[model samples]
Target: MQFVNSKAFAQGLDETDPLRSFRSQFFFPKVRPDAEYLYLCGNSLGLQPRSTRTMINEELDDWAKYGVEGHVEAKRPWIAYHENLTKMMAKIVGAKPHEVVCMNSLTVNLHLMMVSFYRPEGKRRQILIEAGAFPSDQYAVASQVRFHGFDPNTDILELAPREGEDTLRTEDILSYINEHGEKVALIMLGGVNYLSGQAYDMVAITKKGHEKGCTVGFDLAHAAGNITLELHDWNVDFAVWCTYKYLNSGPGGVAAAFVHERNLDKDLPRFEGWWGHNKERRFKMEAEFDPIPFSVEAWQLSTPPIFLLASLRASLKLFDQAGMKSIRAKSKTLTSYLEFLVEDTFGSRDWIITPRAPSERGAQLSFRIPKDGHGVLEALRNRGVICDFREPNIIRAAPAPLYNSYPPVPA
Candidate 1:
C-alpha cells in the first residue's frame, strides 16, 4: 500500500474504514475548545469508552436497590458476576472458555501463575527471560527463583539482543532455548515488549520450551487486544494480561489469565483460596479446597470486583461487536500510515526503533530521541498528540484501531 503524506489519503482511509464509528464511542482529550487530541497512548492507558459510565451506574443502582441481596438479585447478579465476561473475554485472547478467567491484577496474577508453573528442580532450576523483560516480570521471576532457594545471578538467564540490535531476534531466543533449555525451569516473556513494541511469536516459543521440558508463560499486557492471540492452540502453559491498556477498561482495570486445558488437572502447587473451591459447595464452608472443574478458575484468589468488571464488560462488548480480525486489519493500515507520515515529517532527525515488519509489531511505533526528548513529548502534548515517552529516550505512539483517527485537513 503506497501511502502519501496528504490529508486526502488519511481521509480516504477513514472514509472506507468499517470500524470508523468506534471513534465516536470513546471520549478524547481536548486539544483546544474545538479540537480533539491525537490520542495514540492506548499502549499505556486506553481512552474510556462512552458507555462505561452507564455500565457502572447499572451496578450502582443494583447495590442501592437490593443492598446485600444484590449478590443474587441484581440485574446481572453479583454472586456469579465474572460469568458474564467469560465467553467474550475468552474469545479476545483466543482460548477455550474454561481455559480463561478474569481475576486479580497483572502483577498479582503473574505471581500466582509462577507459584504453579515455576517449579525449580535439581540442575534445571534456571529461568530464561528476555534481557529487557518489563521490570515487573524481571522482579517477579528473580524473586521466585530466590524463594525456591536458588541464586538469581546463576539461575536467571537474560537473553539479550545481538551486538547492535535494539530487539531480540527469534533465532537468538530459539538458539538459547536449544542450548540451555534443559537447565531452564520456566521461559517467560512479555508477549509484546512495552518499550520496543515487538510482538513475540508465542506459539513457536511455547512449542520449543515444552519440548525442552520447560514451562512457558507470557505477560500479554501490551499484546492482548492489540494483536491476534491463539493461546490455547499455541499450547501456552499459561498467560496473563491487564485490561487497562488495549482492552479499554479504564485505569488499572481487572486482568485476565489463561491456563491450558492440559495443565488444568495437574496437581500443581498454587496458593489456594476459598473462591477457587467448587461453586456448588462454596457456601457449605468446606475446609478442603475442591477447585472448580478443569479451568483456570482454580487459581482465583477472591470474589470478583464487580464495578471494574462492569467497565471491562463494556469494552469487551465493543470488541465482540467489532471482531479481532477486523480490528487487526485496520491496525496494520493505521500504523503503516503513521510510519509513513513520521518518516516523511521527521526525515533523518529521529529513528523508529520498532520493527519494519508488521508481523513483528503491533499498532505502536517508538521513536528514539536524539537529546532532551522530554520537550518533544510536552510539545506533542501541547499540540494535542497524546503519546507516551519513556525514561531513557523513546516516544511510543499507538494508533488504536478502536478510536484513533487521522482527521481531515482544512482547505
Candidate 2:
C-alpha cells in the first residue's frame, strides 16, 4: 500500500482501521490538562488496559473473602491459575499449549532456559549473540559462561554489523553461523531487536544454527505479540519474553517461556521447585522430584505470582478476541505509516535506523537523532508525543496496533 504523509490521509486510515476501537481499551498517559498523550512507547511499556483494576480487584476480593481458602476457592483457583493461561499464551507465541508457560521475568527465564539448553562442553562452549544485546542478556550470557568455568571473553561471540551499519544483515548472520557454528553451543538473539527494531528470520536462523549443531533460541521481549511467531514449527529450542511491552501487562509484570516438546523429559538439568513437581503428588511432600511430563511447567521453580498472571490474562483475553492475524495486519500498516511520516518530516536530515521494509520490522520506527536533536524528545513530550530516547542518539516511536494512531504533524 502506498502511504501518504498528510494528516488528513492519516486520519482517514485511522477512521477505517479494523483495530481502531482497541485504542479506547487502554489508558494513555495524560501529559497535560488540555489533552491526551500520543503514546508511541509500546516498545518500551505498553499503555495499561483500563480493565486492569477490575481484574486485580477480583483477585483482591477473593483473597479478602476466602482467606487461605482462596487458593482453592477463588473464582480462578490459584493452584491452577497458570494453567488457565497456557493456551492463549501459546497461541500468541505460536506454540503448543504444553510447550509454553507464563512464569518469571525475561532475564530470569533466559537464565533458566540456558541452564537446560546451553550445555557447552569441549570445543563448543561459545555463545553466539548480537553485539548490542540488551545489557541484561549480555550479562546473563557472560555469567552463564563464567558459571561453567569458561572465560567470557573467549566464550561469547558478539556478532556485529558491517562497518558503519546499524543492523545485522541476514546474509551476514547465516554466513557467520556456517563458519563458526560447530564451536558455538547456542545462538541466542532478540527476535526483534530492541534498538534497531529489525525482526530476524527465525525460521532460517534456527535451521542454520541446528545444521551447525548449535542450540538455537531467541529472547522475545520485543517480539512476542508484536509479530507472528511459530516457535513450534520453527523448531526453536526455547524462548523468553517480558509481557509489559506489546502484551500490555502492567509494569514489571509476569513473563513467559517456550520449550520445544521434543526436549521435555529428556533428563536435562533444571532448577527444580515444589511447583514444578507433579501436581498430583505435590501435596504428599515427596522428597523425590517428579516433574510434570510433556509440559514446560517442569521448568518452573516456584508458585507463580497470581496477580501478575491475572494482569497478563486480561491482556491475553484481548489478544484472543483480536486474533494475531488481525493484529499483524494492522501492525504492518501502522508501522509503515509511522515510517512514512518520520521520513516525510525529517527527510535525510535524520536517519531511520529501522529497516524500511515492513516485512523486516514490527510496529516500531527508530530514528537516529541529529547532534542538535537532544532537546527534541523533550519538546515532543511537552507537545504530547510519548516516545523514548535511547542513549547516544536514537528516538524510538512505536505506534502500537492496540492503542496508537498516526501522530498529528508539528505546527
Candidate 3:
C-alpha cells in the first residue's frame, strides 16, 4: 500500500471517516485557545466525552433524590446497573454477557484472577510472561508466585526480545513456551506491548499455553479499546483491562475481566467477596462460597462505583454506535498519516520504533529520538502537542480516532 502525504493523507482519511462526527462528542483539552493540543495519550488515559458530564450529573441527581433507595429506585437503577454495562463490554471484547463483568481496578482484578487460575501444583509451578510486561503486572505475577511458596526469581520466567531487537518476535515467544510449557502454570501476556505498540497474536499464544495444560491470560490495558479482540473465540482462559484508556471512562474508573465458559463450572477457588457470591442467595448471608459462574461477573469483589459505571455506560453507548471495525479502520489510516509525518519530518535521523505495519499495532506510534529525546518531548508539550514520554528515549503518541481529529496531528 502506498503511503499518502502527511497533510493530504490526514485530510483524505478524515473526509472518508464514518466516525468523524464522534469527535465532537468528547471534551478535547485546549491548553491554549489558539491551539488544540494533539492529545495522543489515550493509550494511558482517554479523553472524556462531553456526554460524561450529563451522565455523571444524572447519577449525582439520583443520589440526592433517593439516597439509599437509589440502589433500586434511581433512574438506571443501581440494582441492575453493572448489568447494563456488561453486554456492551462483552460485545467489544467478543464474549458472552456472562463471560464479562466490570469491577475493581486492573491490578486488583489481576490478583483476583490469579487466585483462581494460578493454582500451582506438582511440577507446574512456573509463570511465563513478557520481559517488559507493565510494572503492575510484574508485581502481581511475582507476588502470586511468592504467595504459593515458589521462588519468583527462579519460577517466574520473563521472555525478552531477541539480542538486538526492540520488539518480541512471535517465533521467540512460541519457542519459549515450547521450552517451558510443561513446567508453566500460567501464561500472562500484554495483549499489546505498552512501549513497543506490538499487538501479540493472542490466539496462537493462548492455544499453545492451553495445550501445555497451562492457563493463559492477558493484560489488555493498552489493547482493549485500541484494537479488535476475540477473547472468547480465542478461548483465552482469563483477561483483565481498565476502561480509562481507550474505553474513555474517567480517570481511575472501574476495570473489567473475562473468564471463559469452560472455566465456569470448574471448582477453581477464587478470592471471593460478597458481590461474586450467587446473586439469589447473596442477601441470605449463606456460608457457602457459591460463585456466579466463570463469566466475568465471577470476579467481582464489592459494590461497583455507580457514578463511574454511569460514565462508562455513556462511553460504551458511543462505542456501540461507532462500532469497533469502523473505528479501527480510521485508526489505521490516521496512525499511518502520523507515521508518514514522522518519517517525512525526521526521516532516518529519528527512529520510529513502533511497527510500521498497521496489522502489528493499534493507534500508538512510539518514536525514539536521536539525542535529547526528553527535551523534544518537553518542547512538544510546550508547543501544545500532548503525548507521553517513557524514560530513557521513547515518546508514545496515540492519535485516538474517536476524539482526535486530523488537524491536531500536525498543528
Candidate 4:
C-alpha cells in the first residue's frame, strides 16, 4: 500500500476505516480547558469506554437492591460472575473456553503458573528469560528460583540481543534453546517486549522448548489485545496477561491465566482455595479439595470481584463485537501509518527500536531518543499528544485500534 505524507491521505484512511466509529465510543482526556488530547498511550492505560460507568452502576444497584441475595439474584448473578467472561476472554487469547480463567492480578497469576509448571529437577534447574523483560516478570522469576533454594544469579539465564541490534532474532533464540535447553527447566518470556515493542514468535518458541522437554509460558501484558494469538493451536503450556492495556478495561482491571487442556487433569501442585472446589458440593463445605475437573477454574483463589468483572464485561463486549481478526487488521494499518508519519516528518527512521516487519510487532513503536528524551515527552504532552517515556531513553506511542484512529483530527 502506498502511503502519502499529507493530511488528506490520513483523512482518506479514516473515511475508509470500518472501525472508525469506535473512536466516539471512548472518553479522551483533556490537557487544558476544552482541549482533548491525542491519546497514544493505550499501551500504558486504555481510554475508558462509554459503557463502563453504566455497567458498573448496574452492579452497584444490584447490591443496593438485593443485599446478600444479589449473589444469585443480580442481573449477572454474582455467584458465577467470573464465568460470564470466560468465553470472550478465551476467544481473545485463542484458547478453548475451559482453558482460560479471569482471576488474580497479572503477577499473582504468573506466580501460580510458575508453581504448577516451573518444577526444577537435578541439573535441569535453570530458568530462561529475556534480559530486559518487564521488571515484574524478572522479579517473579528471580523470587521463584530463590524460593526453591537456588541462587538467582546463576539459575536464571538472561537472553540478550546481539551487541549492535536493538531487537532479538528468532534464529538466535531457537539456537540458544537447542544448545542450552537441557539445563533449562522453565522458559518464560514476554510475548511482546515492553521496551522495544518486538513481538515474539510464540509458536516456534513453544515448539523448540517442548522438543527439549522444557515448559514454556508467556507474559502477554503487551500482546493480548495488540496481537493475534493462538495459544491452543501453538500448544503453549501456560500464559498470563492483564486486561487494562489494549483490552480497554479500566486501570487496575482484572487479569487472566491460561493453562493448556493437557495440564488441566494432571495432579500439578497449585495453591488451592474453596472457589476451586467442585461447584456442586461447594456450599456443603467439604474438607477435601475437589477441584473442578477439566477446567482452569481450579486455580481460582477467592470469590470474584463483581465490580471489576462488570467493568471488564463492558469492554469485552466491544471486543466481541469487533472480533480480534478485525481489530488486528486495523491495528496493522493504523500502526504502519504512525510509522510512516514519524519517519516522513522526522526525516529519519534510525531512532526506531521496534522491528520493521509488521509480523514482528504490534501497535507500538518505541523510539530510542537519547538526548533529553524527557524534554521531548514534556513537549509532546504540552502539545496534547499523550505518549509515554520509558526509563533511560525510550518513548512509546501506541495507536490502539479500538478507539484510536488515523485521521489528523483531535486524536
Candidate 5:
C-alpha cells in the first residue's frame, strides 16, 4: 500500500478502516473547552475506556448491597471474580486458561516468577538481560541477584547494542546466547523493548535459551496487548505483564502472569498464600498448603483486588469483540502511517530509532529528536499533540490502534 502525503488520503484510509469505530469507545483528553488532544501516548498509558465507570460501579454497588455475602453472592462473585477474566486474559497473551492468572502488579509478579524460574547455582548464576531494559526490571533483577548473595555487577550480564546501532539484532542476540548462555541461569528480557519499541523474536530466543539449559521468561508489559504472542507454543518457561499500557485497563490496573503447564506441577520454591490453595478446601481453613495443581493460580499470593479486575474486564471485553488479529492488523497500518509521515516531513528515516520493519515493532515509534527534546515535547504538548519524551534525546509516539485514526498522523 503506497501512502500519499495528504490529509485527503489519510481520511480515505480512515473511512475504510474496519477497526475505525473502536476509536469512539475511549474518552480522549481535552486540550480546550471543545477540542480534544491528539493522544498518541498509549505506549505510556492508554486512554480510559468509556465503560470503565459502569464496570467499577457494578462491583461497588454489589459490595454496598451484599456486604460480606458479596464474596459469594455478588453478580460476578468476588471470590471467583478473577476467574471471569481468565479466558480473555489467556487469549491476549497466547496461553491456555490454566496457564494464566490475574493477581498482582507487574514487578511483584516478576519477583514471584523469578523465585520459581531463576534458580542459579555453581558457576551458572548470571542473569542475561538487556542493558537498556526498563528501570523497574533493572532494579528487580539487581535486587534478586543481591538476595541470592551474588554481586549484581558480575551476576547480571547486560547485553548492549553494537557501537552504532540503536536496536538489538536477532543474530547478535543468538550469538550472545551461545557465547554466555552456559554460565547464565535465567534469560529474561522485555517482549517489546520499552526504549526502542523493538519486538524480539521470542520463539527463537526461547529455543536457544533452552538449548543451553537455561530458564527463559519475558516481561510483556509493552507486548501483551500490542503485538502477537504465543507463550505456550514458544515454550517460554514463564512470563508476566501489566494491563495498563496497551491493554487500556486504567491506572495501575491488575497485572497477570503465565507459567507453562510443564512447570505447574513442579515442586518449585514459591511464596504461598491461601488464595493459591485448593479452592474447595480454602474456606475450611486447613493447615497444609495444598496448591492448585496444574494451574498458574498456585502462584497467587493473596486475594485479587476486584475493582482493578473489573476495570481490566471492561477493556478485555473490547478485545474479545475485536480479536487480536484485527487489533494487530490496524496497529501495523497505524504505526506504518506514523513512520511514513514522520520521515516524509523530517526529510529522512534517520530521525527514527525504532526498527524499520513492521514485524520488528508494534504500535510505537521512538524518534531521535533534536538536541532540545524536552522543549520539543513541551511544544508538541502545547500544540495538542499528546505524545511523551524519554530522557536525554528521545520522543516516543504511539498511534494506538484501539482509539486512534489515520487522520491524526497526517494532521
Candidate 6:
C-alpha cells in the first residue's frame, strides 16, 4: 500500500471512510472548549456515545413515572429488558442468540464459568494460561485451584514468552499446549494481550485444547468491540468480556458471557442466581433450581442494572450499524497511520512495541521510551493527547476508529 504523510493520509482516509460520520455521535472529552484531546484509549475506556444520555434519561423517566410497575409498564419494559440486547451482542461475537448473555462483571462471570467447566479430576487438574495474563484472571484461576483442594502454585501453568522476547509466538503457545495439554483441565487466555496488544489465534488454541479433552475460554476485555471474532465457529467452549472498554458502556457496565450451544445442556453445575432460573417458573420460587436451557442465559445470576443495560443497548446499536468488519478496517488504517507518525517523529531512536503486522493486533499501540517514558507520556497528555502509562516504560495509545481523528495522531 502506498503511504501518505500523516496529516494528508488521515484526512484522505477519514474522507473515504463510510463510518467516519459516526464520530459525531459520541461525546468526546474536551478539556478546553476549543480543543479536544486525541483519545487513543478506547482499549481502556471507550468514548461515551452522545445517545447514551438520552437512553439513560428514558429509563429514568420510566422509573419515575411507573415506579415499581416499570418492571412491565416502562417503555422498554424492565422485565424483558436483557432480551433486547441479545441479538446485537450475538452478531458481534458470531454466536447464536441463545449462546450469548449480558450478565455479571468479567471476573465474576469467569469464576462462575470455572465452577461449571474447570472440573479437576485425576491428573488433569492444571489450568494453562499466558504468563502475563491480566491480574484479575490470574487471581481468579489461582482462587479456583485453591477452592478445588489443589495447590495453585503447582496447578496453574503459565506459559511465558521465550527469553528476551516481547511477544508470545503462536508456535510457542501451541508447544506449551501440546506439552501440558494432557494435564490441563482448562485454558483461559486473554483474546488480546492488554499491554502488548497481541491478538491470539483463538481458533487454533481452542481446537488444540479440545483435542486434549480440555475446555477453552477467553477474556475478551480488549478484543470484544475492537476486532472480529467467531466464537461459535471457532468452537470455543466459553468466553467472557466487560463492556466498559471498546464496547462503550459506562464504567463498570455489566459484562457478557458466551457458551457454545453444545455445552448448554451438559448438566455441568454452575453457581446460579434467580435470573438463571427458568423465566416462566422463576416467580413461582420453586425449591429446586431449574436453569433456562440456553448457554448464555443460564449464566445470569441476578437482574442486570437496567440503567447500565440502557447505555449498552445504545452502544450496541451503533456497533450493529457500523459493523465489526468496517470498524476493524478503519482501525487497521488509523492505527497504522499513528504508528507511522510515531516512527517518523523519533526516527530510529524511539521504539513502537506493539506488533507491526496489522493482522496481529487491534487499534492500540504500546510505545516504549528508553528514557523518561513517564515524563514523555505526561508531556503528551499536557499537549492534549490522552493515552495511558504502564509501569516500567510504555505508553498505550488506542485510536478508536469510531471517535479518533488524524490530527491527534501527530499532535
State TM-scores per candidate: 0.98, 0.97, 0.96, 0.99, 0.98, 0.97
Could you tell which candidate, 3 or 4, scores higher by TM-score?
Answer: 4
Query: Model 6 reaches what TM-score against the true structure?
Result: 0.97
CA shift of 224, model 1, Å: 0.3
Q: Tens digits of per-residue lDDT for model 3 on 1-411?
A: 476655676677678778889988987777767656778999988989888989989989999999999988998888679999988998889889998999989999899899999988899999999988888999999999989998999999998988977888888888889888999999999999999899998988998888888899999998888899998999999999999999999899989999998888888777888888887787899988877754557678898889899989889999999988888888898898778766777675247778778888999998886688889988998887888988678889998889877754424
TM-score of 1: 0.98
Give Cα distance to truth, residue 208, candidate 6, Å.
Answer: 1.1
Which stretches in model 4 have alpha-carbon errors above 4 Å?
Answer: none
lDDT by residue (tens digit), candidate 2, 1-411:
888877788889888888888878988677666568888889999878888888888999999999989999999989999988899999999999999999989999999999999999889999999989999999999999999999999999988999999999999999999999999999999999999899999999999999999999899999999999989999999999999999999899999999999998689989989889998998999999999888999888898898999899888888888889999999998888776766677675248899888889999888888774569998988777878988778899888898776646332
lDDT of each: 0.90, 0.90, 0.87, 0.93, 0.93, 0.88
lDDT of 5 at 145: 97
Q: List the residue pairs that clash in candidate 4.
A: none
Candidate 2: residue pairs that collide: none
Cα error, residue 141 of model 2, in Å, equals 0.1
Off by over 4 Å in 5: 409-411
> Between 3 and 5, whose lDDT is larger?
5
lDDT of 6 by residue, 149-207 (tens): 99998999988887977788998888889888999999999999998888899988998
Candidate 1 residue lDDT tens string, 137-238? 999988999899989999999988889888889988898899999999999999999999999988889989999999999999999999999998899999
Which ten-residue region of model 5 has the weakest summed lDDT?
A: 402-411
Q: Put down candidate 4 lDDT per residue, 1-411, tens digits, no spaces.
A: 899988888889999988888888899898766778889999999999999999999999999999999999998899899999999999999999999999889999999999999999999999999989999999999999999999999999999999999999999999999999999999999999999999999999999999999999999999998999999999999999999999888889999999999999898999999998989988999889999889999999899888888888988988898899999999999899899998999998899999988899999999999799999999998888989999999999999998988875452
- Kindly state the number of residue pairs that clash in model 3: 1
Residue 310 Cα positional deviation in candidate 4, in Å, after optimal superposition:
0.7
